[model samples]
Target: MSIPVAGRRQLNERHHRAALGLFLVVVIAHWAEHVMQAIQIYALGWPIPEARGVLGLAFPWLVTSEWMHYGYALVMLAGLIMLRAGFTGRSRTWWNIALGLQFWHHVEHLLLLLQALSGTNLAGRPVPTSVVQLLIPRVELHLFYNAVVFAPMVVAMLLHRRPREAERAVMRCDCALRTA
Candidate 1:
């Protein structure tokens, strides 16, 4: 589970920008899925069960699978943890905020997954539902969680790219703004 220090340093120093770019692409794409699903549900008047985002249209079963949701949550958590070592200072603070929020999201997904696997839906629903979803609807709750996590993540990336002088000095990665 522990990456060697030399290897970690190399990743941070030589490949941080490319790594972060790919990470951002993945995160943004996932966010797009949630947003599109919301659009389908709220704006287009599609039924909640029917609004399953783009992939769900092609793979209908995936829309109904708790495994898919849990897998995505796991991936998001892993990404945040793996990339965390490259951040420092204000960037690290903001990134930690996103990670903390995502931790709760992951827990909620775990609850849903466990309930689905155990043949029991939360609150006696046909499908697995999260704890918060007991109060707030799943669709809206997920959107809110994503927004909360994504906003701070975006801020972290911006701060990482344009760090203060002291932060820049400590950064091993070539990710800071280049002063010409």
Candidate 2:
């Protein structure tokens, strides 16, 4: 059996896919970072200061630091949802949205680094906070990870200035479909 074409909507799918993959990396990283922070809080017996935010109040919930991580993951999901909308509509807006979200990830890393140096936490508390002191290490890893995730897109976007590579990609896909 073979797949059938509905229309010429196949154009520019590769770029969307590449953007989506990067978005997913951020999503994973977001959750992973928070989880790591939470685990340290637990294992190190750090004090989790109770707090409040736009939602009203923050109750530490329990032992896992899941709330901090959960918030991070939610942002990732929002970006992914935006990407899905962008892909289906083939809208440049969606690509722009994805690009914006990816840039934010870098900002978050810098904030984390600032937190490490200044000893600030999400709750505006100082680092190691009688809990974990891995802020410096985590920020170091994040710097490298964020760069890896966005570097490809940055390079691709620069290459698209010529438009030939993206054009060739679409042509190959069309040919593959036509022959198959």
Candidate 3:
């Protein structure tokens, strides 16, 4: 059985806050991994291939798994789309920005996944490469992409929590802080 339209609506109306909290936790955990990977490369002077993040340290294959990366990108995109209705006014606008950026990020991961499966790397490179990766290094490009998407999401959350009177009037979810 599948969720009806009304059930999907309830996700944003009644369950928005909890869902958003869980989504943020996932986002932050992913950020931690990227940050750790960066630290390994820049601070500890570990070579690129040897600098696996926390989970990747134990499961080294995770670093090379295109499917894992694609899955995360898909999850992020889905989360952004699914929770968008909870937002209104300025929050909605910022959320849309984040959604748009995540769509592109998802596309990049899809391209990489395709290449990995096809065994035909972009531009004949041995490994998969994204469109922007042609100009920027993979680590730096992903860090930049995540930061851009996350910045707008944070802005949207802040605005959503402290919504103006008009926004509050339209909100179905109890996500806003109680005003004095």
Number of the top-ranking candidate, with lDDT as the measure: 3
Model 2 residue runs over 4 Å out of place are 1-12, 50-78, 85-180
Model 1 lDDT per residue over 1-180, tens place: 777888777777788888889988988888888899999998999999899888888998987888888898888898788788889999999999999999999999999999988998888998788999999988889889989989999999999999999999999899998977
Index of the highest-TM-score prediction: 3
Q: Which sections of candidate 1 miss by over 4 Å?
A: 1-5
Q: Between which residue pairs do clashes occur in model 3?
A: none
What TM-score quantifies how close candidate 3 is to the native fold?
0.98
TM-score on alpha carbons, each prediction: 0.94, 0.29, 0.98
Question: lDDT by residue for model 2 over 121-155, one digit each (tens)?
Answer: 76555442222224444433443444454454344
User: Which run of 10 residues does model 3 get worst, by summed lDDT?
Assistant: 1-10
- On lDDT, the stronger of 1 and 3 is 3
Ranking of candidates on TM-score, top first? 3, 1, 2
lDDT of 3 by residue, 1-180 (tens): 546889879999999999999999999999999999999999999999998889999999999999999999999998998899899999999999999999999999999999999999999887999999999999999899999999999999999999999999999999999999
lDDT of 1 at 110: 98
Q: Which of candidates 1 and 3 reaches a greater TM-score?
A: 3
lDDT of 1: 0.90
